[model samples]
Target chain A: MLGDNDGILSGAHFLDGDHACAEGAIAAGCNFVAGYPITPSTEVVERLAWRFPGTGGTFIQMEDEIASSIAIQGAVWAGAKAMTVSSGPGISLMLEHIGLAAMTEVPCVFVNVQRGGPSTGLPTLPAQADMMQARWGSHGDYEVIALVPNSPQECFDLIIHAFNLSEQYRVPVLFMMDEVIGHMTEKVVVPPRDQIKITPRRYTKLPPGEYEPYRAGDDLVPDFAKAGDGHRFHITGLTHNEKGYPVMNAECQEQLVCRLVDKIRTNVEQISFFHEDGLEDADVVVITYGISSRVTMRAIREARKKGVKVGHLRLVVVWPFPEEYIRRLAKQIEAFVVPEINLGQVVLEVERCAAGTCDVISIQHAGGAVHKPRTIYDAIVEAVR
Target chain B: MSMTPAVENPVEQLLRSERMPHIWCPGCGIGTTVNCFARAVEECVSDLDNLIIVSGIGCTGRVAGYLELDSFHTTHGRAIPFATGLKLANPKLKVVVYSGDGDLIAIGGNHFIHAARRNADITVICVNNFNYAMTGGQIGPTTPLDAVGTTSPYGVCERPFNLPFLAESCGAVYVARWTAYHVRQMTRAMCEALNKRGFSFVEVITPCPTLYERRNRLGSGLDRMQWFKENSVIKNGVDTRECDIALRQKIVCGKFVDVDRPSLLEMVEAKMASVLHRRRWERMSREQQKPIAMRPMKG
Candidate 1:
């Protein structure tokens, strides 16, 4: 328990998105952070380094992103709230351990501040190209939670949401921010300590000898025991049985991997967060998220002036993709205008959900900058025609 | 052979015996290293509850799976950083990283050096079996020069890493080396390293009888053990630079370095003490301050 303002800023302050993310981690009771300094995201840990010691938190600058990622998982298993922040290049190096966390059901946070990339793309700019990678980067069949914040305000609020989801579901929560949002400064009102809610670690009640480390209970999540609590259980990256022993057989893989996936798939509605505006009697809808959504706002208003009847669907929780809502809305709307700072990453989802029922217009930008309202406005006008 | 009395396992409490029979083969030196490690943990660490073992991927990495203490078999070459996290998160826990040569030296070498450079409060026990035995006898970072392996069938022309030298160079506070045949000495070294304050390293020259020995024509595990017994020079306090293993050469083994140094946790705590004290003072003074914490556990 944070017993004081040690973890909360608790007032309105003009700060950048990266600083807000740091505050969010502390407010969520995250006490351990291991990260390599990275552009657009380095400020997150810099802020943490200055603030953590006072809050009894530990910040380790690891040798590389690979080490940083696994280090956080280690802290998570030891009963500490932990996270890592990085950009595209670091995120690429961290893909393997992200799968390990998902496979092992370790609760932690990964904040990737999106920058341009095929390789070391743009250090100081923005891109949403990693949307697909966030869903399927690690080589495996599993699901993870990812949250996208549209502004500095949301970065503070939703990172707390990210940590809570991670704690409850026992999965890695990806806090997907972009350079545009990360460096953007705005007024963020942090709630008072008691007013904020946090999801505490669910430690198991079974006596040491009787407890099975990986056995799923009613909520489809197994209760955890911290490393030093005398429940000297074995945890591995290998596909394991309920006892957490490596079981190389297919049956164990089927059961374990399925649960890793279904736990998120089955809870899609609870995990899904999106915003809708002007949906009533609209013939066309514009779908976007992160900084792109902010840029699309002006486009939506302009299209309304042209009487395009265009609605806006802003995705707050990007992963688990809001399929059910989009699928239902696809039938009623004539077209879905998608604008993103990448080459049509999330728009593919819109196209899939629409499934030949409606026209999907993708307005793509190749990184280094956010989308312009005119580009999105043009797509809206074309989709309506 | 009958001189030693047969007895029940003394360190049985420290083993997850149900997970046995283990995946180890007869005469494989990994079992010997594991046994010595268990004995050291049994004899040295005062708090069994606080002791944890972290292993990386390899044949030797399997050691964590059988340990009764909280253990993690992490991804290849990652045990050091993972253990560093565990130690930093809860300073009360005694973190020990047990991994193999290829995992700890080749791929995870960066982490190994950095942890040592920072004097992280952890012990690293490296089992050097000459080659990557689990992956069918491939040449490893510690493979002896001119020794044959699956990948180096023509006899390895590449230079082998002097592990003790590397550890010493990386600023490890305690460094030692021993063959699996020297069980008593190995166990004693493990205990000493366990008791050390900062980064300590123990290199066990174990035989991979199944793969390494068969490929290199080193006869049986018995012959390898007999050869090491005859060839090893226990030169205590010898310089680590001369400890490198060449093909069928006299292997120098001993505790090379032992000194006191501040650990990563200590340094970090010292650096942050003032800031933390200030926050505590602010907390005590503030009338409206409340702890930002998660909800309490439900009964």
Candidate 2:
């Protein structure tokens, strides 16, 4: 289906990643947003605050990150496409609610404009350190889709995909943007409303009495019923059965948790998005995501200039970590070099996938800044040697 | 054999009886409060489908699950903010936050005070059993002085919150206090709160028989109810500042604050309407003959 015309800007305009994200969410029919102001990520909510009222949307500045996180789920249950935005510290505070969103299968977006942090280390600086935390920070086992957009234009484009994937899978989709990308200004072309495709929420066609909220179809995704729909459905953080009633047993847990993980894990081919280059005849592949992916481009150029056969693979969807693709490439390539702002997070995944088939080289940074192209170029040269 | 039809309970329509027997223990006063809440729903809410019950993690948080409504049992201390989101998003749903004192006032204290200050349109029913009853009676924000619990075995030394006072000071439009012993009055207060348009709070003092009553040697749940019957003072217009509960002391309970004000959503809507109107007027003036300096007149 086409996006609503009211939300489409439909023109060329200079926009930062944060503002582009707001416009993207609006274009995706996001009617509600609850957020707390944090550096780098605060502009997303600010733009929404200024723009939502005009578009017949609701934007609330919640009390804290925790409130901001859970409030979006509430809005989701109330039959709106909702989201919350924060930085690392705020995302840390929001982890519990992320788990809640996962447990109850609430379709919502959580935007984290990445910052350098173990705890408030550098609020206004860029880092890709949260790559692992976005997948595993929330307690218990569940799957979520995470997207990384390197430019302002992709930020405008991919956030709409983020919302659609969330609605399709009934899972929390993470919009992972670094401070550099979030703050970078560029011209973003928003197409006409009819040109933009949107995935409408899968509301059940079953009658209220016939609907069992947790009963999944063959696709392993259940239909959704909104509040005040006379469904009178109950959802909880506890392990529940098909009727959405709490059932405290291992069998119920196994059934529910396994499906939660399998829905995205089995659909990785459909959900995974990446940009590949020069893999046809390259001895070495440089794998990266987020801002690091952009830096990898510069390093790859330098490596090519040095007469080294270096391939580039940029992860657009980071979580559900492109393991199968990496494994296939690991066999074909001699080595894989990973350059990230963090100290060897995504490198671990590369090493696990490479699994002795190829040597994995990690160019680590403790992250107040991005990796210099020189460092990555050296890593690429060493990997091929 | 002669056939006899089953006589359904009066409030059975509002409950998920298939999920029963409930988890609340014998002699637990939480069920009594639920009865009053059910009665209030029966009397006040005409559109049952539009009512949403949200609760945080605790003994009282189970209220959402047992009620046959569009309900959510959310994370600990988060029911208010969740309800705030629900109410703001739809504006037609009558949202309610039902949880324990520890869930609403301690871990959720920041959200509680802020939601009241914002005047979000939701009703908060905080079941105060003097401690964290769900977690085996740990010390909590509402645990009275000298109360003995697992965490406060030596006796609670810190000052506890006067919840009615806290609610009133934080700008709750409707504030009331009632005990499980005062079911009729509690039901009336819940009805009033349900009908109110802004943030409304009702603090129900109930007995946590397994942990609070046994640990404090308060005999049993029946004895606690007897104590409430004798000690509770009915003061309808009394100041909220005097409604604090102490160790085995006279409990003052009543309706304290009731006022009318525009809610958070209402204020947001009005502001947005005015801004959009002014912008539209400005756009018209710029395209027509009016000067750019001219402003729209205030009502």
- After superposition, which runs of candidate 2 have C-alpha atoms over 4 Å from their true positions? A1-5, B1-7, B278-299
lDDT of 2 by residue, B1-299 (tens): 98899987999999999999999988898899999999888877778888899999999999999999999999999999999988887777889999999999999999999999999989999999998887888989998899999998999999999999999999999999999999988998998888888899999999888999999998799998999999999898789889878888899998988899888866775676577767753553343221012111112
Q: Which candidate wins on DockQ?
A: 1
Candidate 2 per-residue lDDT, tens place, A88-171, comes to 999999999999999999999999999999998999899999999999999999999999999999998999999999999999
**DockQ score for model 1:** 0.57
The DockQ value obtained for model 2 is: 0.52
Candidate 2 retains true contacts at a fraction of 0.83
- In the predicted model 1, the residue pairs found to clash are A2-B291, A3-B291, A4-B291
Q: Write the per-residue lDDT of candidate 1 for residues B1-299, one digit (tens) a residue.
A: 46777788988988899999999878899989988988887677667877889999989999999999999999999999999998877777888999999999999999999999999989999999988877888998889988999998899888989988999998899999999899998998998888887899999998888998888888799999999999999999998989989988889999999988888866765665554566664553352222111121122
DockQ in order: 0.57, 0.52
Candidate 1: tens digits of C-alpha lDDT, residues A264-350: 999999999999999888888998889999999998899888888999989999898888888999999899988888889999989
The TM-score obtained by model 1 is 0.95
Candidate 1 Cα RMSD after full superposition onto the native fold (Å): 5.3
